[model samples]
Target: MAEHRRLFFALWPDEALRQQIAAISATADWPRGARRVPAAHLHLTLVFLGDVPAERVDAVRSVAASLRVAPFELSLAGCGHFPRAEVGWLGCVDAPPALFALNTGLRQRLRTQGFALRGESFRPHVTLARGLREPPVLPDYPPLHWPVSEYVLVESRRGRAPAYTVIGAWSLAPVSD
Candidate 1:
């Protein structure tokens, strides 16, 4: 039997912008056992491909390489909690059509390559914290915006807390005839 790893596609935030978000998250009164995402690991997940065989890594890389979307601007607008009980997060205000299209295209490509995916529609947002005891009331913060230039395929390791490792990255450049 081979080792199984959790994989996903995501867009990491720029260093400066990530730092700014971290500063804001620090001010929030998070719940117990809630782990705030580290500044280095802040990202918007595009697809969650859970528990794949190691042998399939190359195939996944190829699927990512074949993507045809250019970089676009993404902005963080507000915060909210999932289930209104656990999982606090900052929400994306205006996710452009290109962002949805890009995710949809990637899902189609991955499906063609025999990768089973979660059947949920893509909702682009960055997770700020998890395991909250109470719902969060978002503070008044100026919008945080940044250009998304690349998407990465990451392997997530399960443990006391999940840790992510980047396996491959695809740059998004505009198509030319």
Candidate 2:
């Protein structure tokens, strides 16, 4: 049997940002049995490439490396819940154009490389809590600004806690004024 790994591309936050995100998550009034994502594992997934065969990892990395998008700032404000998924999240209310462009272009590139992907619209968000029976009434939060500079490929390992291993990273091009 071919070895397969669960993979995804995401924007990994720095320690300072991670701490800030964790702090905000701490303040949320989560219902009982809700599992808050650990600060170390907090990230905004750009693309989910589920269960890729070991030999195909290189192709996935190459697709990310070919990205020529520029860095952009993302402001995550407010909270929302996916009723069907029962997932609580923080998201960008007014996202910048570059963010969408980056996702669209990246997905296109990956698809062109013979990777199968779901045709779902991209909603920029960070999962804060999961396994909620009902949506918790969340307080209004000030926008958290994130200066996104790079995107990375990550491997998800199943365990008691959420564990993610960064496989590779590609820095976005610096903006030229």
Candidate 3:
């Protein structure tokens, strides 16, 4: 049997933004079946490339390395629910062109190289909680500022606590303030 690894590409948050998300989650009137995501595991997935042979990791890394993205500022606007998915999420109400462009480039490369990607249209969100019986009423939240400087390829491993690993990362070109 061949060994394969489950992977996805995502934007991991800095500590400052992580804390703000944690604060927001702490105050929610969570539904009985819902479980809040751990702050440490918070991330916005760009592309979910299910299982791949272990040897194909470099191909994934090459796609990441070829991106020419610049840093962009994103503000966490509000929360919403995916009814079928039973997921409550925080999302940027505004989808900046930079974020769209980056997603396009990265996914295009993956597709050109024959990798299968999820068919859903890209929606920028960080899942806040899961297993909800129904959508909870999300109250207004102070916007959390996100500084997008890099994207990483992460491996999802099942374990106690957060089960994710940063296999590789590439920085977006820095723009001077």
lDDT value for model 3: 0.87
Candidate 1 lDDT, 20-82, residue by residue in tens: 888888887776778788777788989888888988888888888888887789888888877
- What TM-score should be assigned to candidate 3? 0.93
Clash pairs for candidate 3:
none
How high is each candidate's TM-score?
0.92, 0.94, 0.93
Q: List clash counts for every candidate, in order.
A: 0, 0, 0
Off by over 4 Å in 1: none
Error of 1 at 161 (Å): 5.1
| Shift of residue 89 alpha carbon in model 2, Å | 0.6
What are the Cα lDDT values of the candidates? 0.83, 0.86, 0.87
Expressed as tens digits, the lDDT of each residue in 36-66 for candidate 2 is 8888989998889899999999999899887
lDDT of 3 at 156: 90
lDDT of 2: 0.86
> What CA RMSD would you report for each candidate?
1.7, 1.8, 2.4
Model 3 lDDT tens row, 90-126? 8886877888888899899999888988875899999
